[model samples]
Each structure stands twice: as C-alpha cells, then as structure tokens.
Target: MRTSPPEPLAAALVEGRTSSLKEPLLRDGRLLWLEQRPQEQGRTTLMLRPAGGDTAVELTPSPHNLRSRVHEYGGGVYAVGGNDLVFVDDSDRCLWHLNLPGAPRRLTTPGPRAFADGLIDGPRRRWLGVMEAEGRDQLVAVPLAGGEPQRLHQPADFCGYAALSPDGRQLAWVEWQQPFMPWQRSQLWLAAVKQDGALEGARPVAGARPVAVAGSGPNATDAETDTYTDTSAISVFQPLWISPTELVVASDASGWWNLQRLDTASGAWQPLLPLEAEFAMPQWVYGMRTTAWDGQQLIAAAAREGAWQLGRVHLTPDRVGTPAAWEPLEQPFDDLAGLSAEAGTLVALASNPTSLEGLLELDLTTGSWRHSPAAPCPLQPEAISQPEPLWFAGHGGVRTHAWFYPPAGGAHAEAPLLVKGHSGPTAMARRGLSLGIQFWTSRGWSVVDVNYGGSTGFGRAYRERLDGQWGVVDVADCAAAAQALVAAGKASAARIAIEGGSAGGFTALAALCFTDVFRAGASRYGVTDPSALASESHRFEARYLDGLIGPWPEARATYEARSPLAHADQIRCPVVFFQGLDDQVVPPEQTERMAAALEANGIPVEVHRFAGEGHGFRSGSVRIQVLEATEAFFRRHFQR
Candidate 1:
C-alpha cells in the first residue's frame, strides 16, 4: 500500500550507472567490502564474505596500496601506507602497520610527507592522528604501543582527532586555530593519564576560560589570584571516550553536530546524545575518526531525517541527568558506504543511487538488522536505474536538493541528458543510491544529483548559499536545476551532457563557462583555477580560496572573471576529461590546460590521464576506464 516512491527520478542530471559505497571493515566473521568499478579501470577491489555469505573473497588483487585514500578504520588492526610503506615483518622498514593478513608490524618513522586519518584504539595503545605537511597541525601519538607521537594540547589551531579512553585513561580531542573551520569554532580537549603513563596536563573540556581562585599569603597570592584565562572556548567535532571519565564529543554547542559529554576529572558536563541531526563529520584523515565503541554504548554516524544513518547512544553507567536518547539504527542512505561499530556487531556499508555497496549487520543486543552482501553490480537488478528526489526552487528562496535517475531498461526512444558536476562545490549530492546514477538511469539516460549552493544538509542558511556565490550561484543552480528539469517534462532538450568530479569538476567547468544548461561537458579532478586554488592549496585549505573566491591578489579580476580556464573562447560544447596523473588536487595541468584550450577552440576536447591517480581515480582499472569511457563518450555525443 505504500507504493508512491517511483515518480521522483524525473530530470535526474546524469546517472548512466553509479553506485559507490565505501570501506567499512570488520574481519574474520567477515564484513569487508570496497567495490568501485568506476567502469572497471578505476577499480577498487576488496571483498570478503561471511556475515550472510555468498562466498565473496577478492581480498585485494592488484591494489597499488589503494589510491584515493582511506587510511584507517579499525584500530584493532588497519594501517595502510603511501609512498613506500610495506610491512609484513619490516620489508620496507615499516612506516605504518596493521593490515593483518600476515601481521606486518611497525607504525611510524620516516616523517615528512604526512596526511593520515582513521585510527584510535587506545588501551594497549594506538592513536595515530598525524597531519603535518605543514598539515595545519594535529599530531598525537601512541602511533603503535610505542612512543614518540604524543603532542596534543595545541589549540591556537588544529590539533588532530585523538579520542582514546575505553580505559586508556583519557584524551578526547579537537582544536582549531587561525581563521576557524572545524565548523568555525573548536577546542574540545581533555587529557589525564598518570598512573605512570604521562600526559596529565591538557585543557579546555569544551572551551572555557575563567580560572583564578587563590587565597594564600606566604606566596603573596589571591589578588584575584592574578587569574583570568578564557581563550574564547568554542569546541565542536567527534570527541568520544564515553566513560572512564566520560566523554562523547561532536558539538555545535547545540546548533547541530550533536553528541556532547564532558567530565575529565570533573569540569563536568553531559548530553551524550540529543539530536535534531548531524552526528559526525571529517572523513578520510584516516577514515573512522570517532564513533564506534561498545563499553556501554556509542554508535554515531549521522545526517538525520534527510538520510545517512547509524545513530544509537545508550551509555548507562551510574546514570546521571539526560544522556540524550537518539535511536535510528541505520537505514536511509543512498550512500553511507562504510562504517564499523563494535561491542557485538553494527557494520553497514550501504549504497543505492544504482547499487554496489553491500554489507550490514546491526545487532547490538537485539535492535535487530541484517542486510549483508547484495551490492556487487555490473548491472542487473533489472539493470538497476532508480534515484529520484528533486525538490527545487533554489536561488535563495531556498528549497534545493537533488537526485534523479532515469535510464535503466527503457530505450528512451531518444535518451540523452547527463548533467552532474558534483564534487562538493561544499559537497552534497546525496540521496545515497547510485551506481554511477544507475549507469545513467539503467540505460535510457538521465540523471541529476545537484545539491548545489554550498550543500550540507540544508542549514546554516542554505549552507551559505554558495558563500560569495562561487562561480555565480553554483553555475546558476546547476543551470537552474537543468532548466527546471527540462521545463518539467524531465529532460531531452537536444539531450544534455555534463559530468563532474573534484568540486563537481568545478561545477562542470562553471557550466561550460556560464550556462546554456549544458550542451556537453566532463571534468574529473576539476577546478579551472580559482587563482590556482589560491596559489596552490594544502594547509587544510590555506584560506580556502578566501572563502571560495575573494582575497587573492584582491580577487584578481574576480578570479580571472570566474575562470572556466578563463573562458576558452566561450566554449561551444564537446569536452571530455578524466585526470589524476597524480593530481595535487586538480592538477593534471588543470586538465591539460583545459584540453589545450578546448582543442584550440574548435571545441571537442579530450584528456584522460591516470598514471597513479591522485585527486581522484583509484583504480578498479581506472574506475572501469572512467565508466567505459564515459559511456562511450555519451554514446558518441548522443549519436551526433
């Protein structure tokens, strides 16, 4: 009787076949899956069987240390290297360890090119949070039960994700400095471990600063005790440590990020749960970063009521005032793709846009849930094709958010429309389900996934409505949501074509240099120079293009007048790119100088690189050779 979910895939931008989930790891009882198949060349590989077995086991066939980054997820054992980090008994002198399979051993040494995320398993010790490439700073330790890694207490700007204490004693982290961003304000700290193990001095339980209660005499004290401290405290982010001294972290104080709890030796605090939504963030620094405990309860991974799941908090030790309820136990994710909670099961590796992320478990003492293995696809679920949810109205009157898939087994009498451009121009193009937008809506062709305007679960004022309005209203709200879904009949205005990658390939080269609602486009590893991402990025955003465009030699002529490679003679249509020739973040010469200026302006361009992929494109054979060469270049430009 509830059969009204199919009408939503209407003007789906460009979903020829998409479905990308994530890493989620468990091991032994089995629940590992990392399928990409980006057509086959951008392949990812890693599948184990068990939970509900159908007998899958590719354990990693030809993984050049898995690209596109997913550093760590399970500290029980999981550490991958980069630029030489071999391990099975010190073969490459081990720089990072724990990928089991043969017990490699060795965790850190050989500093210099850093960047890792996903590690924190305290109690026999193991923390790893490094980030220095001038990594804006956050280098904690216990990198491997050894020594030399402890450096917390650093909030004048960015002090990595620490989290410890299931009995490791105490150490919840999150600090921020220099021009904000950790959601604008952070300073969570909390350390205390002495029984001979050190680290007993940290500060800020969640930003505070007013200490000066003196009253001595022999030391001439109590002049207000010459004390005042308040560093403007503000805290926010996945902090964990659920009990030992109590801690749960993730804050917005209460505007969203949720979770909260503090007590480190009693500056005392609480809220262990309490949500309107938003439970955690910061993916890939190593991967897991916080959430996944079992002592009493702590599950986290959120985005509430608008999808993305896995939330559950129960901590019941000497019960205090409100520990926040929050229930929802996973389900509603067109793409959660990875997660691995503990204390008796809770896996999840979802995906739906078109399918390819399977693996689910749940069970934490009968909350009951199963779903395991049912996500591998090259096509077939009736050839897939199903992603719908359009919303619209954007342009500040608000109401935006997109996801549409149409193409599966329908022949379309004339099919053609593939507008995408999504790479977080602020990130958002979620409704989950997508196997490359069901390989372009199964086969008929049509897919649109724009959550344009600085996306992030519709809040903080429609996510700063694209802040200074990057590339003019995110390329006119992705060409007015593809001309309001082909004037509402759902696509086919002479068939559209637009694709994206990094920053949705900079809004598909700024919607082919300022809109006409896409005629032809594609950009993987995008960004056609925002003053060269503010003279080369990495400092965790080095002023993130001064808030997306401005403050760079004074907006140097509005970043070369909103650069689309500075208007390659006002593009005519026909472009193709897929780079990663080791992308230093949108650098393959920014797509070979925009494919030699759109192949000398006659338009019809092409690029393709992949050597070791960098900005994005981590083999599965170059994501199925960039999804079969962008579906044979949109079927040779829609059959001409």
Candidate 2:
C-alpha cells in the first residue's frame, strides 16, 4: 500500500469530529447506540443497528435530545425492553416511552426530579432506575403504564447503578453517604422486591447493618428508612446478578477493584479474580458497564497500567480460583467500554490509539469480531500521531503513567508540550485516538495525557497516593511528566503548557500556581478553590473533596492551603479558563475567581464562560472556540 503524505490538522477537521459511539444496548437481536453529531451542534441521537444488518437506523428524530443530566455526566439516557423504550429527555427531564409504532409518549410528569441509570424490567412491567428529587437520591420504580414514580429503596446521600435480578424479584444498588465519594467508600445493598415492586428487607452485602423497611422492619414509622450503614472504608460497584441467588460485584476492599461474588443466601463473598487490574471504574456517569453476564459465561473489561483489555470467563460447575483459569479474549482495541453480552454474542464500544471508535460485536463461539458503522480516519496515517505509553517517577517515587504523542513529522525538534490531565482525578486517561489530542500533535505540539496518581487502572495502592494529597500529587505528577519529556529532549521545558477539565483543570491551575514547570495553562471549569467545591458542588460531588483533600470544617485550613486561588499571587504565567455557566460540578464562579485573581495580579488571563454548556463542553461551536483560543494563547506564549 502506498503511504499517504503528512498534513497539518485543521480546525474544520476538529469541528467535523464525529467518532464517539456511546451507550450500546443489545436486546432481542438488535443493537442500539448513541452517536454525537457535531454538525448538529453536538446533538446526540439514538441509532439502531438491527441484528444481521449492515446499516444503522436513526431511531430518534430531530429536536429530541435523548440525554439525561441527572448526575451531570449523563448516561442511562435510554433503556430498551424488546421494542419498548423508556428514555430521559435532556430538555424536560421527562421519561418518554416509545413503542416504535407511533410517536414517543410522555410517561413521567415533568418536575425537579431527574431520572437516570434506567433499567427495564419487562417481567414486572416497570422501569427501574436511580432518581434524584428534592435534594435526595434513591431507587425508584416507574410503572410502564405511566403514573407517579414510586420510591423503591431507602434514601441515601446518593444512590445509583440499580440492577435487577434475573427473576425481577430482587434489586441491587450502590449507595454512598456524604464526605465519601463512590470511589472512596460505598456500600452495596441487596433488597427484596415487594409484590408491588417496592423494595423491602434491604440489607448491606458488604457494609453496614441490615436496613429496616419503614413500618415493616425493626425501626418502622413510615414505609422507608433513612438511617444507612456507615461503611466509610469499603467501596463497591457494578452489582450485577450472575445468577438469581448470586451477585457479582467489583469491590476495592481488597485493595484493587477486583471481581467478587456475593451470595444473597449466606451473604458470603467469593473472590473470582484477585488480580491487580480494575474490573470496575469510578462511577462518573450512569450505565457504565464493566462486566456482562449471559447466564453461562462472563465478558469483563479490565484495566491495568492505563490500558483496557477484555477477558472471558466461562461459568461452570467447577468455577475456581485466580484469573488464570479464565479464558483471555484477544481484541484489536486497547480501550473497551459498555460491554454487553447475550446469547453467546458480546458487544462493546472498543477503540485504540490508531483505530476509530465504534460498536464492536464479538461471536464468542467463532471468535469473530466486527465493528458497526465504521468511521474511517479522514486524515492520512502519517498525519496522525500514535501515543507512546510512558511511565515516570512522580511525587515520592510513585510510578505514574502517561500517553505521549509526538508532533507529526518531528517538525519541531524541541516541540511545545501540552500536558493534559483527565477529569475524575479518580478516572484514568483512556487509551484511544482522541481527535482533540491529534489536533495538537498535528500542529507541531507534543501532547501527554497523564494518568497521574489517584487515577484508576493502577491498583488501589497507587490510586490512594492522592489521599489527603490531591492538589499536591496531581500537580507534581503533571509537572514531573513535563520535565521528564523535556529531559528526554522531546519537549521544550520553557514552552511546556498544561491543560485539563474539571479535576484535571484543578491540576492545571495548581501546576501554574505552585510550580514553575509550566509557562501557560488552560482550565476547563477546573476546581480553583477546594473549599468552594466542597460546599457548592452538586449532591453527587458535594463531599468529593473530603477524600480528594479532606473533610470540611476540620480540614478547612488544608483546603485553603492547597487551593490555587489562595496562592494565585505566585502564578505569573498567562492562563486561560474555559467554563460553562451552567456547570454544576465546579461552579463557574470557581473559574471566574481564578481568572480574576490572575488579572488582579497583573498576570495575563482570559476567561470564557459558555452558555448552555455544563461541566464538559458538548457544543461544537464552543469546543472549536475553546480549541482555537487555547491554541492561539499557547502559541503566543511558546517561549520562542
């Protein structure tokens, strides 16, 4: 094959970017997923690929945004039971039921209540999910025939990832109280499904005391209980039912987020795979699938060292010890998401640094894999920069990993390096070809997407490196990665710039303030003041800083000492802050304060607050605008 020539990446290419295929749902020989259309101003619609079909059908029409803003980073926007569908509308937060024969009918009333992580239970004739109402989160059951939703389980500070048993008589969900993020510590509960679909006799499988059902249990005055088990050490997630009596979960009690099974009968826990890699990720959004079970076999996505790979485990009567006994499935992609399996067919959203992302289907029996609606790379192969997996010593000799993308054609011998930190502070940098990163690398800038301390993929030992050291560890790791790149002659030390969104944005601000490694920085709604984030953040992340930094009031001094806003006088570099006015995660005022502080200090500062956008930029126009503005700002301060 003849090699194509290299070319510079254009903003139009970024504006036309379309490769994110999200929320793959497989049922009754049909596969449906979401595709974001940049040309449509970042409008997302549902696309269906029928079983054995080559083309996909756009199920959702125009002006209908099938998205949920429940937890901010929305997911579980739609659920399918055969042909019946229940989805949350982003515009009105209403649940709409679609039968595919006519227009979608509104099922739930419009109110302050937002529903997400939807699961359809055809046997019970109800839709199950996590509901947030009046500042409380709980598991709710909505009748398919359309009426007021019933609060099924007890209210907690936050609740999500409600999964139904195969028999539909039992429900399992995860809940965490204040001051502890889901990743920090959460309890897994299994509740008995009442005759009317109300949850009863709820008990913690891995945490606190058995929950009382209102007037039915030991402490009964009403129909629900508010006092929950105080399990502030063990974190659990992905409570999937492998069998009617047994539930599989990924718990971090054993250090890593490993796969384990909880017997609903004896409540005994069984360790399936005690490996170091994580089988479950931090619950940033709804409906994040890490493992899929088909009653006989299991397909799981596991992460190690920042890369994700899929594995297959056959369920047998003699199912035993370590992950060594399980079968390892070979795949072309390094990043796997949304793993769903049924009837020997497994589907996942897979991608790599060189491949465009799409819905990948695998035939377990034949080991045949295929991707639907394949997106071919518009740019020539040479124009794209493949990321080189990098690991370096960061803060206290901790091993930190990052993906380094060199500039195309090696044009700049000492290229301006852009260190990008991922959000989640708890989330890992995905191993895939992100056009946003390519946009920088193709424009003669080296990019490093850092999976610093506190990031997932690495075991709990490495992840906890940020405990009570959030601002310190993340900033050190980013600066260390940049300095290591400069030491390797890959990046110009004086021209290094740092950029991030959300928690990552906090790292960028901290790097610019506390360190001299970066000359310029861009924060996309970054946390400038930890105190503001702890007090003013949403219910989901209100107490996140407790573990990220420390608990409030008691750790008030620590938060102030670590916050970038407190030390803005030391940051002399030009910084650009891009924030959404509607961002509830890190309030827009956080970014505005940082910008004002920089400007007050006579340091160059630019702040862009976008309307109609949340924590993350979804609109194409704003994305393009932020990209262009950041590039221009970086070029202006590249230290020629």
Find the candidate with the highest lDDT and give its number: 2
TM-score of each: 0.33, 0.94
lDDT (10s digit) by residue, model 1, range 442-475: 4567777777777665444455676667888777
**lDDT value, residue 472 of candidate 2:** 94
lDDT of 2 by residue, 564-619 (tens): 99999999889998999988788788888888888999999888889888878777
Alpha-carbon lDDT of model 1: 0.59
The lDDT per prediction is 0.59, 0.81
* Candidate 2 wrong stretches, greater than 4 Å: 1-5, 209-232, 316-324, 411-413
Identify the candidate with maximal TM-score. 2
Taking all chains together, the TM-score of candidate 2 against the true structure is: 0.94
